[model samples]
Target: MPHIIIEHSASLDTDFSQLLKSIHQSTIDTNLFDASTIKTRRVAFPQCILGDGKTDFVHVQVHLLAGRTQTQKQHLSESLLNTLRTLLSDSVSLSVHPYDLDPAIYRKN
Candidate 1:
């Protein structure tokens, strides 16, 4: 199972619902997970400061059960990052980090 959590600055003008759909589709394009199983959500920071105080940001963290090969993980990360690059402005700080959850401890129920 994988959970896509998106964190962004509230000041940024973007449609998060569409972003979620785009990311979910990109994840499906990787052929790593079923479309029905992918979970996506977003959290906007209304009060926060970026490094330069003028930069807005969007950071995506993908958490999944640990087992995927490094190449697969890298591909997932790059694919998601590329999606962000196309949607967000150049001035926005964008990043994608894929985290492997311990399969032994991760539970959905």
Candidate 2:
């Protein structure tokens, strides 16, 4: 299972609901995790600061069971960022990171 958390500044506000949908779908498109097993959430900060305030930023963190190879995670990150970039403006900063969660400790209901 994989859970994707999207964090963005308020200044970059656009269609966040649609952005979330696109992210989730892109995660599925990676074929690394089942669409039904994917999870996504977004947090918007109203008073967040970015370097020089030249542009807003969006950071996506993917937490997955500790088993995926580097190549798989890299592909996932690249694909997610590419898809997100399309839904965002050129001035918006974007990044995607993947973290390996300890399968033994990651408990779910």
Candidate 3:
């Protein structure tokens, strides 16, 4: 019942491994659930369709699957957004979406 979805701009020079590690560690440190049970998915878009260059926006969506209390979810969302903002260049715009779902439906045997 715990899953995390993270989406970011493809243009950003991101270290996927490090990001995953950070999320994993944070989830564990929060003591909200079993670290092993945590599930995270990250997607980066190479090219995004923005509104006539009105805003340089990068969409980031994070879904916490299970064992996340309401407060925990809020904290995670904030932490993730802050992390991305710091990691990305100032020229690029960043946006984060907090979502949730059941992992069982997306799990692979």
- Model 3 poorest 10 in a row by lDDT: 51-60
Give per-residue CA lDDT, model 3, range 36-82, as digits (tens): 87786777767776654523454556555655678877876677666
Instruction: Name the runs in model 1 displaced over 4 angstroms.
Output: 52-54
How displaced is residue 1 in candidate 1, in Å?
1.5
Candidate 3 lDDT for residue 77:
64
Q: Positional deviation of 38 in candidate 3, in angstroms?
A: 1.2
Would you list the C-alpha lDDT of every candidate in the order shown? 0.89, 0.89, 0.63
Candidate 3: segments with Cα more than 4 A from true spot: 51-60, 65-69, 102-109
> Can you write out model 1's per-residue Cα lDDT over 23-59, one digit (the tens) per residue?
8889889999877888999999897777865568999
lDDT of 1 at 54: 59
TM-score of each: 0.93, 0.93, 0.63
Clashes within 3 Å, all models in order = 0, 0, 6
Query: Candidate 1's error at 80, in angstroms?
Result: 0.4
